[model samples]
Target chain A: MSITWPLFIQVTLRLLEGFETTCLIFALTLVLALPLGLVISFGSMSKFKPLAYITKVFVWIIRGVPLMLQIFVVFYVPRLIWDLPAFSRFNAVILAFVINYACYFSEIYRGGIESISKGQYEAGQVLGMTKTQIFFKVILMQVVKRIIPPMSNEIITLVKDTALARVIMVAEILKVAEEYAGYALIWPLFYTAVYYLAFVGILTLLFGFFERKLSYYKV
Target chain B: MAFLEVKNIKKKFGSNEVLKDISFSLEKGEVLAIIGSSGSGKTTLLRCLNFLEKADDGVISVDGNLLFDGSDRSTTSDKNIRRKRLHFGLVFQSFNLFPQYTALKNIMLAPEMLLKERAKKEKLSAHQKREEHEKIVAHAKELLDSVGLSAKEKSYPCELSGGQCQRVAIARALALSPDVLCFDEPTSALDPELTGEVLRVIRNLKSSDRTMIVVTHEMEFARNVADKVIFMSDGVIEEAGTPEEVFDNPKSERTREFLNRPGF
Candidate 1:
């Protein structure tokens, strides 16, 4: 097929609009999930047996199911149970993505936190620091250093996982590419691969920088 | 009155009974070395003294002020526990220096937090807070120098040798000037050559009349430096006396066997 300059430009612009939706899903999920994951991790690690068990089971359920199935459940379950109006397609995608990613992030957080030696907490305690102070001032950065590699891997996976929104018919980049495939123009579908590669490449660089910055400490 | 006193400190973990009964007293300017085999509860006693572990029963008084009383519910509050912990500083066997911070910053951190808290409580002006911060930095530098690591202020824990890290840990513990500084096998993690540097800094602290409790496996160090020596066995003190009296003339069978072990 002969490709004209205008045709390529037109396809690029439409894909960019769809890419905005993809980016929004990625950014919003991260913004909401990062802190929420920390809270969930604390709940799982709580001294209260009931709270800890419930949080653990919740995280287990979220992780055991597939992401595509989760998106569908979020979109359909509320309306089915309550006879309420279905959520907006975008909100359902966001809700499902947040819960899924937060559970994964919480496990990474728990691993990083539990890896620290008990001696660190005892050192802080003997120095007269409160439990909160010990966490923020002493343990937090060490945990960050330990979790960065795992966190970055999960984050890069999220960038691609945004395409899962297409299952909910959210007109994300992949959905736009698929729409072109219906027109029997296969090149734009290949062009979509370029965008994902660039996005992941940039993220790889960013995470590498953070890893180096935190490399001064060997936790 | 003793400078520090403990009455029947008892601790248990799941009925294991790690410390059945521990009681001791230290006068000001005295060094008390607690010598014991592993599992003898020496470390637990130190942890309890620092409030890292709560003793099930005990009375701990520092400078003649009651710090912890198991019978007193009012003394066990979170706020009271933190305040009481300030009376003691502990150096761990592993030299748990904050790895992300430099030696100087590790020493400065707790004191800075303390100063910040005081500044808020006192409603100090911005200028006053800045001045207090400078004082903390200066004090931290002085502590680093005292531990003979003046040249290593900016090095992280990973960059330092085990001995160097322990010295920094010592400086960090001394930054707050606790009434009683405790060491829980402080040199046990170092190489034979490296142990000397840390021991030297501790010996200097002794000459300065800093009250201390040292839990150690070093028999010679305990005999030469400690004014009082305790031999612990099976969660209790098997023998307690002057170093000469304990080492030269041990009364307990366990103390005699422990001192005559192959390594000693």
Candidate 2:
């Protein structure tokens, strides 16, 4: 059946709303996970053996499991093990995404931070900067510049991964499109690709802008 | 009490001892140059002086303040070491200017972040704090001017040449006005031609009454600028004396060997 212009607008607006939720999940996960990733990186890189080992193993487990499976585990395991009520689908989806992405981001952060020469730290220390001062003032921005490329890649992947929220019954873009597909209109499913492409295209441009801005650091 | 005193500083890396019983004392306005081949622990000794590398056994005093007693380096909290570290400013061979900062910002950062934090802790009035901030900014500008990089104050480390970056690094180190300045092969990272520009800046510092400890391979600079010269041979001081005594009338076989190498 051919869709009229009004019908197309209606479908597009509905998908846009769904995309809003997708963006929210993406944004919140990033906001929480980025700083959390840095903290986890410190843990993974800690001089204390037990803390470092535990953090590394946890990161490994999170990264080793599939995101979809992690979503299931996040949604079900708390209730299974503790007899707690299930969390909201949005909460469960974000929880899983945040934990999984944080592990990935922490590894990237650790690599970026560790790759900095020991001399940089020494330079800061000699200036009488405290450890916290050294990390925040000297190390943090340089680490941000170094990690941006890999970080942007992960973020772009997160744009696509937001669809996985559907596994937890969160009505993000893909799930919304799937609902339309039940009406024998497959065009809406194809239509979902347009949203993802536009979203990712915008992200790619944003990341390109950041990379250009940070190029001044020169490694 | 000397202006700077380092007593029996020893350091180890795993199975290898990098610095062994290194001791030195500097008077106010005196410059000491440490010359040695790579792996001789000259750099390590300098690093230990600033508590950058924890010494296994030693005592360091700067302006009569005890930095740490190496008998228990671990027991010395990081806070104590960092506070004591303010007494010494170190310039690296690689000119580790913060790459993300402009040359002026590199000089301004330590003073701004540090002095402001200290002022904040004292609960200084905003007007007082503002005065402190302005003072640091003006001082940073003056330092940039002194280094002959006033025109390049806005330039990032990547934009500056090797000598310019080292000068900026020197300016940054000097921004805090530490009791002593330590240079670890400051010119080794520059081109032979560019090395002259940095050496000239350092030579200017020689007459300024700043106590300095330089670890370098520039024999001519060592002879000309240093009041005393130390020849480090395999983690120990093979010879240390006035420039004439060490350079002209070499005594130790190892010191003579290092000075009389094929290049010399």
DockQ, computed on Cα atoms, for candidate 2: 0.78
- Model 2: per-residue Cα lDDT over B114-230, one tens digit each: 777888799989899899899988999999999899999889999999999999999999998888999999999889999999989988887556999999999999999999999
Per-model TM-score versus the true fold? 0.98, 0.95
Interface RMSD of each: 0.7, 0.9
Worst 10 residues of 2 chain A by lDDT: A210-219
Write out the backbone clash pairs for model 2: none
lDDT, residue A162, model 2: 92
Supply candidate 2's per-residue lDDT for B56. 83
TM-score of chain A of 2: 0.96
Alpha carbon lDDT at B110, candidate 2: 87
lDDT of each: 0.93, 0.90
Best by DockQ: 1
- Cα lDDT tens digits for candidate 1, B52-131: 88899889999989988889977766567888989998999999899999999999999988988998899999999999
Reference contact recovery of candidate 1: 0.89
